[model samples]
Target: MKKLFTPFMLGSYRLTHRVVMPPLTRMRAGTDGVASPLAATYYSQRATEGGLIIAEASQISQQGQGYPHTPGIYTQNQIAGWKIVTEAVKSQGAIFFLQLWHVGRISHSSFQKDGALPVAPSAIQPAGNAFTSTGQRVSFETPRALELNEIQQIVDDYRRAAENAKQAGFHGIEIHAANGYLLQQFLEDKTNHRNDRYGGSIENRARLLFEVLDAVLEVWPNDRVGVRLSPFNDVGDISDSDPLELYTHVIKVLSARGIGYLHLIEPQVRSGLVEDMNHEAPPSVATLFRPHFSGPLIVSGGFDADTTEQALAAGTADLVAFGRAFIANPDLPKRLELGAPLNVPDKSTIYGGAERGYTDYPRIDEIGVNTSE
Candidate 1:
């Protein structure tokens, strides 16, 4: 508990605490892929002085978008829309970073321009549904395999988006290489089946990721860039035949590059005893990769206040990212410090909604009680 409250230097910035607000996709943007005006209020409410808030994932291009009402950083209007949100968060003294995203095969043709199929490293169709631009869930479409030239174009798009993020006044940028997106699609053997320079071997498969990072570095320095990876989590039906070997090499390369931080998504721990687990739970991602990376490590998934403190104290994780808790409790750091009860998030209104479950969550003092008996 004491360690959670202490200040620590994350890259060049000194954060007041270890509690971070990870990027959560709340589909509240406009039809033009502009951020909602309410985003300012929503983010500012959760911000604390010297805290870190990675803004929601914004697509680098129209082809990069996978869902409706999710913001983009490609257009000028989108960049201006995000500027408002960043200004609001900065006003509260929070360091803000925008998560640059590209959903790749996790998208439908409807989300693409002129009904073009979604692009990926390979044309394999994921097993699941995809949200259409109109909010209808349809079967996942088999994405088109990107040509070698197209791969370079997408990398350039990431570089342009990084420049847009800089124009939007973000303190830094986090590449959304996790969640089985385009970057993860290239990294995982199950998704990437190409035999060209961008696939086959692990080094070839990881080529696009490093290229994108290198392109992004041209705009922002390595110390201001962060990369998110989910080595074990299979959010987008993503998997690798050899995750340990692949991520070990990836982390070592990133550590050598001296990036801001490595944000890792821990595997979801199911309820029950260790033996009663549905599958063999691998060791904690933070513990296994902690020694490999030298920079700050932020771990996200299924962490409560106690577990967060324990991770920090044990030195496995430098920072713990809270997604749902920050959604329901605007003043999460303050509430944790006081040991106060947290507001439960409404499940139904988690996405594509107004301010009901978005900005309506009350702070501790705003939660009135009938004490005048």
Candidate 2:
């Protein structure tokens, strides 16, 4: 049997397989920022016994929101909405995790309360468009640099959000520090131009991330917390002067803390775009960071069954995360094991839609395959 199909121990949990479903944002939530009822069905359809699933990125506070209809965990209604999702996923005996997110400068004022400008580590304007509350693409605004006291508030927000996830029945939490979001805005040099404790040197720039992790760790054990990072992929037009040095320090500290896992996005896959599997790549991100991170490492971005198995066999990645493939194949593990065909995902319905592209994907058995024969 392939290593991808074999059982593996992640922290204290025994996973039946190494195939993980990473967080994918589908803007199907209501204007109140509560998850749709269909979200429960969507997640339960993909859950497998002893498998791991990281649900979509959810805002930790109203200030953390950047896009329309994305779920939030701060409100009572939001917590109740996610409780249903967790219950459905738990019914399948799978380990469910919620990815905590704060979009930082990747926002327009329209999405903020009182139409306040988005906040980031600095008041820099990223070179991209922001999605408005009405789904219009508007130019990115120069974000307000978070005040020294305000930084502590954001940290508190993360802690409160972690508590909310626990209330929502999540087994764990994954901090969204990757893909040029708020946390990454603080990590990279281009986005963070502050002279305070949160900027300048590599250690200073990484202070906010460490602070957020420490805050979240206060709510749950370190072993139940995961941190996701994108060292090479430059989404949000953000980059660091020396990614290797920065991530090396980050991974080493995380290793020392003995977190549950370290999830890295492969360099080949750009954020918010369909992956080009045939693209040539440099040394794999997993291989580069494997030696530094002592805990279980999950590598996401454009991985199929063959590559996933190869990654596990090579010991470069303890687990592999599939985003798009899993979006189209609800029973992805069974399909991969049976060598069955997968459904093609409709890009048009990937975000802010109802049940069509979200939970309607057919299982292998439903496709008229008879594995029992």
Candidate 3:
């Protein structure tokens, strides 16, 4: 467990500890998809010196959005808004990576530009609900299948978003291909039924991801870029007939590319969410697939300190990311180091809210509580 707090070099930047803050969308951005001032305060409070913070999923284009008030990276206002966020995180000496996102079939026309249907690899309706403008969760609608030309445009959006992240002062960028988002929709066999060059075979399913990566690499070096994947994530109507073969190939391809790191949401969220909603079952160890990739592997889901210790000790994960834990404890790393008590997060205020639960979670010192006796 102590080993996790030890400094490690990730590409050019050296992280102080392996306790990473994975991207968590707070839906606090403005209606224009511009990050608000509160967003800056929210992130800066959690920033730690030499730590890594992957910012919340930000839509790469207006068409990329699926939820209300989620931030975007395409417009000038959006870029300018993010500048404040990146500068705030960097000022505290933490490295910030913007998670570029596109929600594909996981959206409704209410969130789409010009009321057009959401686009996806196939005209499939994901079995899930999306947050709408009225703050209501509505069922997902069937998406429009993307043409070859339109696919190219989406890749360009990713490229331009990466460039915009650089302009906004982000140290690096993370491509969100996980959790049944746009890229994952294209990767999974169930959602992607296209007969084009981007579908059918395993190689074809992964084509769009690589194309977007290639475009992103043009803006940043391979070492400054990373991709997030969920080999067994069932959310957003995602599934693969042969996950092991599919993911092994994907990992091998990424390993060869020598990208900085690979962030994976372990399979814990599958059957684990039902038993104990508070405890996310630890993701199945990916040690079996470790040999397929040589770059850093960061595993995230529901991980306690002991589990984090075991994962690092067993060499299953290089870094452990905490989402809900970080939300409740702004000084998470410090609390862990001191073995301090954590603040229980208010589930109600997690999504669209102000400081009530966003930045009001008190640190140990602020409340004068010490659990590390």
lDDT of 1 by residue, 29-80 (tens): 9999999999999999999999999999999999999998999999999999
Encode model 2's per-residue lDDT on 1-373: one tens digit a residue. Answer: 8888899999889999988999999899999899999999999999999999999999999899988899999999999999999999999999999999999999889988899999999999988788999999888999999998889999999999999999999999999999889999999998999999999999999998899999999999988999999886678878887888989999999899999999999878656632323143356878988999889999998788788888888899999898888889999988888787788888898888899999998998787887763
| TM-score versus the correct structure, for each prediction | 0.96, 0.97, 0.95
> Candidates' lDDT values, in order?
0.90, 0.90, 0.87
Please list the residue runs of candidate 1 whose C-alpha ends up more than 4 Å from where it truly belongs after superposition: 269-278, 368-373
Order of the predicted models by TM-score, top scorer first: 2, 1, 3
Measured on C-alpha atoms, candidate 2 has an lDDT of: 0.90
Indicate the residue-level lDDT of 150 in model 3: 86
Model 3, residue pairs in steric clash: none
lDDT of 3: 0.87
Candidate closest to the true structure, highest TM-score: 2
Candidate 2 Cα errors over 4 Å, as ranges: 273-281
In model 3, which range of ten residues has the least summed lDDT?
A: 271-280
User: For model 2, what is the error of residue 57's alpha carbon versus the real structure, in angstroms, after optimal superposition?
Assistant: 0.3
Model 3 lDDT, residue 305, Cα: 91
Q: CA shift at 209, candidate 2, in angstroms?
A: 0.8
